[model samples]
Target: GGIITQTPKFLIGQEGQKLTLKCQQNFNHDTMYWYRQDSGKGLRLIYYSITENDLQKGDLSEGYDASREKKSSFSLTVTSAQKNEMAVFLCASSIRWGRGAETLYFGSGTRLTVL
Candidate 1:
């Protein structure tokens, strides 16, 4: 019934360059999150926002920045790209965040490649 859209499905960046990714959801969910996925590292939470204009950093938020400009959109930026690295960035939304209260709907994801 709802969909999450992540823009620029593929990204190519140079080392040390800053790259940005974006997400938009039509579910009107109360919470939105950004996650980074790597081959062996699993999914790591990068940032989350409980509501518009509210930001919360996660374990991997150090090298990233996030913004919830509107309830329907969220954006993430990689402060410094790593050379020859590749990863997938995922965007998700939920009615409310909790251990077992709700399910997270994910976007197709944005794939990043650094040269």
Candidate 2:
């Protein structure tokens, strides 16, 4: 079995400030993703990396940047924290699957609060 780890279970940032989150996995999976979940809302994909050093922008990629520096780690940076915003950022990994049902295992999530 494999595992994924994300640092700093909570994040606090000032409005308009830049914040970063880190994730690591031991699964050796081919795909890793970063997503944002607003209060009571479904997860929205922000960015995904298909391979080391490969980045794919998702529907929610605006105002964010990500990096896949190694096969086991991926990092995401929030370019700006919005006013009165709160969200949980999640990191996930999946094995390579062309089309069918590919399940994603997620991190506990980093809760962010803008003040």
Candidate 3:
């Protein structure tokens, strides 16, 4: 079995500050992703990388940036946190998809709040 770990279970930042989050997975999967979940917005993708050094922008990448520095590690940075913003950042990995969306395993999650 494999596991995913995320650092800093809670993150608090000032408005307009750049905040970074890190994730590591032992699944050895080929694809890793970062998504943001708001109170009612469901899950919105921020970025994904199919392999090491590869980067793909998702539906909600406007204010975020991500990196796949290695096969088992992925990180995300909020360029500028908004005032009173709050969301859960989820990190996930998959075994790669041949056609449709593949099943992804996620970390516990990192909660972020901007004051």
Candidate 4:
């Protein structure tokens, strides 16, 4: 696997504003996923795509948009930012073959702040 790069290490936005985060990977993995990690909580899946141009909604898919732009890139957008909210958005890519053992690589994460 290769490295995953996320844009805007720290993002600040106002309440009710829309925000977008981008991720890029060189691994060319079979699947890519977007997850939200909140304080003191486990990661919650926002979206995932098994291939290019494919979009699949997960638990936190509401109020967000996701796109698998190409084999090496994925993006996520927040439709509306909540007031005084903070969270870390994580991007991950994995190669899952028949073995059921997938190799996953993750980006450092994009920190979001809504004032």
Per-candidate alpha-carbon RMSD to the true structure: 1.3, 1.4, 1.4, 1.3
Query: Which clashing pairs does model 4 show?
Result: none
- Poorest lDDT segment (10 consecutive residues) of candidate 1: 94-103
Off by over 4 Å in 1: 98-101
- How high is the lDDT of residue 6 in model 2? 88
Q: What is the lDDT of residue 47 in candidate 1?
A: 100
The digit string of per-residue lDDT tens for model 4 on 32-70 reads 999999999999999998888889999999999998889
**Per-residue lDDT for 1-115 in model 3, tens only?**
9999998899999999999999999988999999999987789999999989899999999999898889999999999999988899999999897765588999999999999
Candidate 4 off by > 4 Å: none
Q: Model 1: what TM-score?
A: 0.94
Models 1 onward score TM values of 0.94, 0.93, 0.95, 0.94
Which of candidates 2 and 3 reaches a greater TM-score? 3
Candidate 2, residue 62: CA error in Å?
0.6
The per-model lDDT (C-alpha) reads 0.94, 0.90, 0.94, 0.91
